[model samples]
Target: MKDKRDFRLEIASIESAGDYVRDILKQYKCTDRDMVRAQLFTEETMVYWTETANEGDILQINVRKRFKTISLSLSYRGAQSNPLAISDEEEDETEFSFIGQNILIGLSTVTYSYENGYNVITFTLKEKGTNPVILIIFALAAAIICGLIVNRFAPSLGPGLSASILIPLSKAFFGLLNAIVIPFLFLSVIASIFNMENIAQMKRIFRILFSWFLGLTAMSAVIAVLAGMIYFPLQNGASTGVNEVNIWTQIAKMLFDIIPSNIFQSFLDGNTLQTIFLAVITGITMLVYKGRFPVISKVVSESNLIFSTMLDAICSLMPWVIFICIFDMLLSGDGRVLLSSIAVVVLICICFLLIVLLCLLSVALIEKQNPLQYIKTIGPVLLIALSTASSSATFAPHSMIASNKQGIRDYLANFSIPVGALFAKPFVVPVLLLMTLFVGNFYSLTFTAADVVSMVLLCVILSVAVPPVQGMGIFLFTIIFKRFTIPLEGLAMAASLFMLFDYLMTTGNVFSINISMLHTEQRLREKDKRVIVYNNQKC
Candidate 1:
């Protein structure tokens, strides 16, 4: 594919670049929407290059299509003028340019690198198949029909057809997603912690980090409160739970289990936080002894290969897993509840994007960078994040987006991305609070302002403490449900009902991590330059 589309054209002939790119899109027979987007992408890349190229430089562009994505590459030998890099004086820009906001942030993804003497900019256009979406719709529609049939015929069928068949199948497939969750968490956390560069960068960025998070956390909580007001209407009905549960025992058990008695047993029992505890200890030990034992460090560095292979295999079956999960849920005769719950969950998720965009654009304006372009290169990372709902799993993809696409310095990218993967939960608290409120209404539980504040504070603390594995949001919410005296029994139903929103929340987490990494690195770089100049003047 690389050799097939190789071309050499003089700078004078660069006007035809978009036409050349359009031909490739035509050959692939992409949708009209995608074709127009690709054309726009090519035009932007051309403008960036043509404005910055030197007198003797030549422009070489390549067009490649793989699976469902198209990569349009523009390589030119020239003096490096990275359009993405803004000057220190420009850092004070109070407004972000929205000209290519969509392409930058979401419409398409663009990455730039300097190789040898050539500047190579690659644009990735992700095509969503209407066919697959339609198929998904059909699967959902099929679930509804199967549900109606099963509910109507339960009297005639002994033990029920769905009970004997579909339910088990659905649980089995869904369980596969959870198979790699713990190991992936352990490997990623351990590997990230042992990397000394990560620690050093964390120290440099620590001061601003808290304030940044504090702002995002407050915004998330505010968003949840507003969303609750709109969606969680007060209902007068019988209380959902009879209040028979003991709160202290549940709290003590959850706290005590965080430190497992046996690490091996914890893995066997799928204890996420306990596994995280063991991994953190191991990572710190490895870091301390890395100089003395090179062999240990070497082996740990290679461990990601094992987990990556496993995740790829498991996540490949995700579409089918989702289909089965939805089918089984419908088959249980709660189709009406499940569908409505999904709609509400989806609304809060849609609202989450606003908060993410607000954070990203705000950072971009202050830093003098384009938010659209920043978000664009991060598309692959966010896509993987959404699919896995595990930052640990998406670490590899995020690393690539950071170094190759976004041009984050190697040390900072390695450090900040993993740290973000582990500790970042910008949207988790708000979304979880919204879920609590939404589900609370079903149980006729009205949340006061104090309850909201306590919930948000707990969420902020828990998001950082928990292993960034799947289902952990609901796990935290379950504890909060107990604390707020909301009845522990309704927790499972809330988890089941609002599972889909977790994917969106995780995606937002990774997205903000990338943005935060960019902002932090830029500030540190500028700070270093200032110190150097100050020392020079004193000398």
Candidate 2:
């Protein structure tokens, strides 16, 4: 069918806009939820325009479907006006009149511009349930099929095609990821610190919770190193990359090297350790002197928003990157190497499961609660985490379970869940360690004692420092693999496997957060009991 639909309606008859949107969305067989959202968006914009424009003014609407993206554009040729403008100076504009504007904004990608003397507003929405992970998997399968076909029929063309197209595109993808990681990391850390509410008031709980996060991550790192050594030892061809320098000296240098003499140089060099240090210092300075320098905070906030949106756009390219990378690997005869890494994937999954179970049991026994019952209570949260692969997406249901079923204090649960959603990463530590080791051994790059120490330290720091956002899995993989001086092929391999690991990693993170909250609640209760007993004795 037709990909484009358009309509011109009088401002007074704007109510019909909803019907127009409904008809177009239904043509694509969009879900009812999407239909309703489009209709609501149409109605809201129409109402706002109806109020702002003359009675007889005409509003032109265009709806276009491009693959999975459904874009709607509203244009009017009168004096410029933005229907989505929230703070326009109008006598009729009330706070209540703008109630649903933010919701509409959140529901879709909204843009406004003045082009060709017409004020245009556009809303772009994606079809629901289009899981990027599944898309990447399908792309991988398609690439394998196509690569095999090409390899059998036209063997001579494989090398040229890979060298010319796939290799350049693969480099471009990593280049984009590499360029964005440092700034994204810098802004995200600052934003996360600034986002926390009442840090002074919640310092006690924050310290306790932060300790739990670190403890879990450190434990995961230890497990990964030990397990990696057991399951996948260095082969005969592997080189340990050990230098003549003393291991202790290397450790000392790494520890002191985090403080950058020139911050700009640190940024230029893409030094994450120094970047993280700078971020912490800047975040705390902004937080302390927040009232004195409001403009810097505003700039930081706006910059974070811009970078976050750009990062999402980059992440959407992942499926394409996966297809090309896999296709290139097959053409280059590295398919066998990739196939051998299945054991590594399986091992990572098992380690995550074991960690989750261990945390659950430890928290249950310490709090005197039944482990089975705890699992049953948080099962829905885990299911959402597994399906969505987003810790924030599971926040609402997890909060409900924590407060109502688990008997966690409401305020504590609310505070802890948001903090956990952002900072708690139970799976990243182990996954990073294990994958790096596997790749190291694959490349015959041996890790000396100092190398292991440095890698583990870096893993634990990055796990908590990086915000859990879309595309962060790929970003983290790039950072960890690159830091270890592992080759680009290792990074590519890890990036390809991230689609499968993300779901399990997210679930593990959710599971660990739930347990940390339980422990936090228990500690608070015990502290209160002690205070009460001491006060009674004094009286």
Candidate 3:
């Protein structure tokens, strides 16, 4: 019938809570104890007592429970002391404000500060709910809307004004893109090659590369064929009598032109794809003969480092470059034309993404891995990729997840992702090429068998040359296909929509390639380990 005894205690540190709780409980270590209860508290929850306890006031003690051990500490304001508790009200205000500011600034910018007995936190708020990327998106949307409105309302003024506005923006975007492409390609390709040290490694790398190349080519061929069949682009209307330039002749001219009758002319002319070709050849030759010429080897090594630094600097500007590109594309009134074909491009992109996903699932199931687990492992990177639409930007996170989470080897992820970033435009090549064929048909431009081969070959070439960014593939597509009487403007229109889905399929490509490489490597390692175990057993 004895009433239960209670004790109250305080702890100096969360880390020492166990010892303090134990000592307090030892006090009630008596035979036939009726009942005992203990409650522990930290200063974090005891703000009122600390606040009210004056310089000399004995801190009021409360014993609501009894325990064998207890610890307590109290200090006046502004001293190095133990953790303290704040009342629910104070905690609520502070915690909620912290969370609110975090929401405003975004988690990436939220940071904490503690100084002079005061906790300070700061957050950066986007103006009018617009960050840089969002601002670009809005500007692009507005530009497109204005272009359309002006075109519909005042046709006479629209095209001229739109062209004037868009041309400059396009030029600037083109310049930025041009500046980045050569250096990026140079570093990415050379680094990828160097990452593969020997011929055996290169062989494996090429096997995967060839597989992807063939897969993309086959998919693009199918899409081009389907588009040709469905749209019957060439048979749609009266022949424009566009003498389908001999594909071979055009390719010969292209090859000749890329030799840069004058290198300076090529630079001034913004021949980026040509520049990439020249750079790759230079790098590969240097790599292949590094042993023969020490001087050339050293020069190449230093150049690679310099180029890598420059490439990094340029890449840091990619998000902004993409913004500028999107903005200019919108501002120039090109987006208005897109409205007509946007649905078609969007449908095509969705279908392409679905196809890539199906292919990824097939790879997963064949390898006896969980498809959903693979998807989840790459989910965050995929989201970032979708938002930013840059595969290289997704590289760090993708590599981390593949290596740390998915158990893929770091070397394989690092090597394969960059290489895949270079060549894996699964959707871009297929969709843009198909759209080009469709445009040709719409214009009644005869696309001969030669033209078809030309398109595929161009896609393959550009797939190799273009930096694997959001719209780079499409731009290259426009440059190449425009030679065949396909409207460059239509290709640009298709690109605008293609950019929206580029991230999804690019992520898919990275995921697929990484998983394939991982499983392949895992199987090889497992086989080697088994071999070693058997040899050891025989000994």
Candidate 4:
């Protein structure tokens, strides 16, 4: 006889367990009479043991085999504890056999237990690849397609529609151009002035400025000479046709006309040179009387602020204006002919980019910096300029890189970049000079030594005078050289070509100026004892 305990066993597949039990019973030769004293086990016991079992939990089974009588007992034991006993009636063959077989077969029973914790799902994957080379190629192709499509198809759409589109867009771009111009100029000039406040500072400033001017002049001279030599006006047949006006007389008129009759009228007429002169005078006056007339100085400061704010508001429209300008230019169908003349355009752009690269290398060498590193540092701004074709638009990014990454002082970058934007006419001066010389020679018009000097002088002067604004320089050049029979219409012809090259040249100029200024500053900081030495006697 065996004691019975209150327990229950639940089996989901009782038939399978029963079949397994019968086979084991047969092997043991146990009949109903022999198993009559044996205990029956339920599925609940098997589940409970498996669910509560830890890695070291163990099961103890007792089997009694006899010819006419059989008995079995089951119990559980932990590694550190004594085994718990079970009654003979509580020992069930089906439950014990099922669980024991699963343990032997290495079947796993998973029981989820959550304590105070969070479950986080993690995924492991492979790294992704980036193809910058392919991206750049695609971008270039897209730009070309855009240019071609706009140039070829926009004109057929008509002017009234084009104007409606372009005017607002141009105004928006022009607004953006306008907005930043004043603040950029004001901050830049003030920063420059502050940097060069003392005599020592001024000496260093002038030294750097002189070196920059010298380098620029050298580059301009080299390009001018090379371009002039390559595209000699004589290559085109000379015209002996009588002129409407004498060359000397025309030159005289140009000289007089440059000195504006009324300053206000100059601004109204968008005379950039005149406006620059006036602005410089005003800036100087403000500086001279800053402390003595505080009220006036305050007014000047406020005016600068006002101008900056206005300019910022205006510049907000720049992208729109640029789009419109591009759209209108393309829509006019002028670019169609220009596209057909792709060889000339490409040749000119390649030559210009070459010159620009050469000049940049020169600056990098002079500064003892890695040229490629410098190029990479300024790469983004250069790309922007390449796409936008406007140095004015690129100035913000250029200044930022110059100041932050290149370790140039904000004051120096702000001042040098904007002033450089205005004065560094790398493409404009060289191309205009080359074209003028070429045209003058083509007409068999023999220029005097004085006339040649005058042309160079004009190029230098206008280059400095032109503000960093689109169409401003071109318009000024046309007005100034109209009397010289330089064919103002040629400006229109060159404008398309100029847009492509301007990006490279402007980027080059900005980069060169930043490096030059950095070098100058470092030299000054390192050699605190040396006064600035000038090789040329010129101021």
Best by TM-score: 2
TM-score of 3: 0.53
List model 1 lDDT by residue over 155-180, tens digit each: 34524655786556655644554555
| Tens-digit lDDT track of model 2 for 1-539 | 23444445445465577777787777776656456656666777777766566655677778777666567778777777666544424422242224323332332245566668787777665555467777877888988898898889988999999999998888887888889888988988887666442445456677887788777877788777677767865333234334444557877888899999998998899888889899999988887785477578667866776676677788788888878887888898877766788888888878887787788678667987788888888999999888867665665678789889988877666567656766678688777777788777877777665567677788888888877666777788787777777766566567667767888888888888888888888888899999999999999
Candidate 4 residue 304 C-alpha distance from true site, Å: 12
Give each model's whole-structure lDDT. Answer: 0.59, 0.73, 0.48, 0.46
Q: In candidate 4, what are the lDDT values of residues 289-310, reduced to their tens digit? A: 5446646544444454345434
* TM-score of candidate 4 to 2 decimals: 0.44
Mind sharing the TM-score for model 1?
0.50
lDDT (tens digit, per residue) of candidate 3 on 392-469: 556567778877987765555655565565555555556666666655654456665555655666666666554443
Q: Tell me the lDDT of model 1 at 326.
A: 54
* Per-residue lDDT value at 403 in model 4: 67
Models 1 onward score TM values of 0.50, 0.76, 0.53, 0.44
Which residue pairs collide, candidate 2? Answer: 239-446, 240-446
Q: Which candidate ranks first by lDDT, i.e. highest?
A: 2
Worst 10 residues of 2 by lDDT: 99-108
Task: Give me the runs in candidate 4 sitting further than 4 Å from their true place.
Answer: 1-203, 234-347, 360-364, 390-411, 435-453, 529-539
The positional error of residue 370 in candidate 2, measured at the CA in angstroms, is 2.8
Cα displacement (angstroms), candidate 2, residue 505, comes to 1.5
